[model samples]
Target: MPMRLFNIVYITILCLFSTFVIGQTLEILPPKNITTVQVFNPQKNDNTAIIRLGSNEYLLFLFDDLEAGYKRYNYKIEHRNADWSESNIFESEYVVGLNNDYVRTYKNSFNTYKKFTNYQIQFPNKDMNVKLGGNYLLKVYTTNEDQPIFTKRFAVYQGNVDVGMKSSRYINPTYKDINQRIQTVISSGSQNLTETPDGGKLFIMKNNNWNEHIADINPDFTRSNQLTYNNVEWTFEGGGEYNWFDTKNLDVPGLTTERNFRKDSVYHTVLRVDFPKYNLPYDDYGDVNGNFYIRNNRFGNEYLAASEADYSWVYFALDAFEDQNGLYEPYVVGAFNNWEISPQSKLKYNPVSKLWENEYFLKQGYYNYQYVVVNTKNKRVEPSYVSGSFWQTENLYQGLFYYRPWGGRYDILMGYGEVNTRN
Candidate 1:
């Protein structure tokens, strides 16, 4: 057999016999009772889960169980490659302490109509610590079950390299007004990166949405110790700012909320009807770029709000009669659902009202969302179909650099950086 084909077959067998095979995509697989899964850096006050290695920084993982009772939940951490596949290295090589352990922090909801038990865990604790800087996955599961309730992705970087990025209008004339391009440069300070053709990889994501990203991009130019990525294909849709509404207080309606009422002993918030922005000019009203944080305006303490905040049924209506043909399906997407399309977020057409409507049971917080369409034939998600695209739209772009020396067992996260279009 050829050398390359033999190596490929060997790797496939190794992955199959491994403890677990993380698929190509990073995703969350929560059951029906799970909601509001969030992983973020508490100190940074943002949803991005990238942290520096060997620093005091930690990533916070929070989720709520609608079952409303305490349960014995355990978590396990696994190292992954830049492509999100299981790494070839052993757990002991990547983790300094126990890789699997129990979650000791939880709280029951207080003074809320909807009953729930919130579970939280912080990483790099005494029980568990990651020694290697690379992609990692946190899997939460029942004490006795091998199947995970949900899995989340986070990254650790060594900061050994300096990564810089700049954004501008796309070079293509046809997409110049509707798309934005990013150019990246990585300076390897002291690390000796392999000079092989396939030794390094770069990934770029927009607005911290891992579901949609550009991956496996090689540097367009290489210098003494610097790599540059100026490819024209590194362009993303400059979708308009996310539509936002506040639900910090259940008793009082917030801006963009049409009404708030008590129904079935629970609060219900109806947002004003929305319209397509394809033809409308860009509106830079400022938004969190499709992120949300739990808050209860009635309380003075944030931690108190975490447990005291109530859940409500939020109603959304989009009047897109012109775009509501049988060829496309509309979905309301945001960070609440990890920006993934699910059955609950899919809007149904109401013939009587001539609108697309859907409702989500969400915790008390301010949220940003937008309407997107899926092409029926191609199963492609088009954010610009309903939200519109413009070069002036502000966006947060993140760049990650990964390196794997020749004959290395796994990839190492050497550098991480962010760039904002409005900056």
Candidate 2:
């Protein structure tokens, strides 16, 4: 990364003040529940990690990089003046665990398809702690001599979930909104996909809620696209919850094991984003005047799962009313940005009402996103993506744990991620 880029990210961390708290960062969070993963190297010693306002529980992490092995990290929030300084409350080195024998086979050109042998590395049993305040960091390394391989940033609330008790913030993170749909539904499809020699083939709702081009995606890198819905007014409220249900709730065996503790499993609303249908069908497949997505990484634990690759794609539509330059504006946000609405994906404003429009092509699966206004006053936000929700891809989120430490049962959450819509 360039010095300027690093500087820009840290600068934004300082500026992330949330209406709910002292401040916040808008980055995608990691999957809250993951049991199995393949890390590249772990035999070596001296892997250190750092934290800002540390916690008293197990590690709070963004889903690690599958390619590079976990620890690519999120900046989160601002504290102690919001600078990366020591007083900022959070910052430190980390002790990360790795599963070395995660690969199934090595398909080298030499006709050697060897199963990745198990190196017998172990996961941690205790919670990692960084006892301070303000914004902090976690840096994990192989050894003092090795370069820091994995990095994560988090904010310590010093409080609990019971604190935010209004507008569904405690349970769902997003609350009332102008564009919120009276009712919304979402589901997932598959993760292990076979790419056609021609293109990708992701399954989505029969309706045009997703992109036709998405069927052709087969990338190592992924992105989180919000699931559109109603009653979601995420205009700078520091932190919130986003719950994505698994498809098993729809009753497809072997696809999922999640059962609703309550009969209404689909009633759970996690994230939202714009759908292709928002625009009249005349637009080009590669055009959007304004649109974007947002994330919650600045705060603790909130992250983009599976490295933003295997998750749902976030889509937004800019104002067609904007000028020809509308497509050139910002239409996306979330943890991907440093938190602020970015110019790189801005919505090009229409000359009619001078409103802008934009769109995003995200990965398939489920997610939570905010429909922002972009301007400082956040005056340009849209509610269609917020309130007018839709259902797209249907993927299964399976959580398996090696509880015995060596060879325990792989416990998948019963009603953990079953995605569905309300009756």
Candidate 3:
């Protein structure tokens, strides 16, 4: 194993074990009732992004080469509910594919012969597929094509991490036996290694990236035997004292992040949104992500969510927001939006708003999210998530991660941060 590979495995194990996604291939499964066509992978561009949420893994992918388009391009995920299949987003409850809500379909494509990326969309609900943490296949079909197209089976894993980490190295008659019980995880736990109680040392191997995050190393404490052997880098997640090397690693509070930079600064308009409880029937009457969105175009005391781990979504209705001519679709823009806007992540129009609105599910951390409109052709866009509203509401945020090392049990670690209006 290479050092980086060990780091990834260690960190992967330290973070969480997802047996479902590990090394699983995408394949075509059947027993179905939908029209199909020629489906295959070019071996190279068969790119896929698998996400593990809770106990389930969601795959977001795109496919290409459609001869034509249709009024309704309905797709279905076919699978069976068995005795050991764990759980399904829809299973063992009632009839399958009962309605559109359980299924996600795209109607009327702007389909063209031009090269398009992110062309595939799949919502592999637990029913159409099993959550057994293994590899499965995907079959593609079209209202136009005839035979079901076969795909390479991709792996979906549900592996988690180990916990039970206590102190390491105890040499003495009193706490020697006691220390061994904490997590005598290493292959070697001989007494010769322990020179003294405080001097005696024990070690825990963490995956690369599985780091000393949130908590910093105690300055007064020193680190020995911190080196690499074989392909693995053996070090500590950090310890000694409590708050030694702590200055908010990875992410600070009230901050935002994005993969693409669509614009410069995303406008965030904070609102006093009351999620209709009893008397209310819908959302965003004053909702930002709502259809009947209150159109405010300013910034506010917008600090962070009450919880530190909230990256807000920016929703805006599109009503001639811009010229509908471009390679990119306009989605609500914000710092989370990465500033760029066009078609890939654009918002759909809502008749109720009499405008168009887009929604984004942000990372569970801090930062202001705002409404942004973009023109893919000109590449011009505007953001305003922070705007006008009589009601003032701010958000505080927190982050928590659970993980276990490979071959060992696991535990959960909760980290907190405060991201206000400050950078």
* lDDT leader: 1
lDDT, candidate 3, at 32: 19
Best by TM-score: 1
Whole-model Cα lDDT of every candidate shown, in order: 0.81, 0.24, 0.26
Clashes of each: 0, 124, 89
* Clash total of candidate 3: 89
- Kindly list the per-residue Cα lDDT of model 1 for residues 250-308, writing each as its tens digit: 88889899999998889999999999988898888889999988889987555677778
Which 10 consecutive residues of model 2 have the lowest summed lDDT? Answer: 396-405
Decoy 2 TM-score against native: 0.31
Poorest lDDT segment (10 consecutive residues) of candidate 1: 1-10
Tell me which residue pairs clash in candidate 1: none
Estimate the lDDT of model 1.
0.81
lDDT rank order: 1, 3, 2
Per-residue C-alpha lDDT of model 3 across residues 64-178, encoded as one tens digit per residue? 2223343233344322111112223333232244222221333322221121111334434544544333223343544422343433223333323111233232233432111
Q: Which structure is stronger by TM-score: 1 or 2?
A: 1
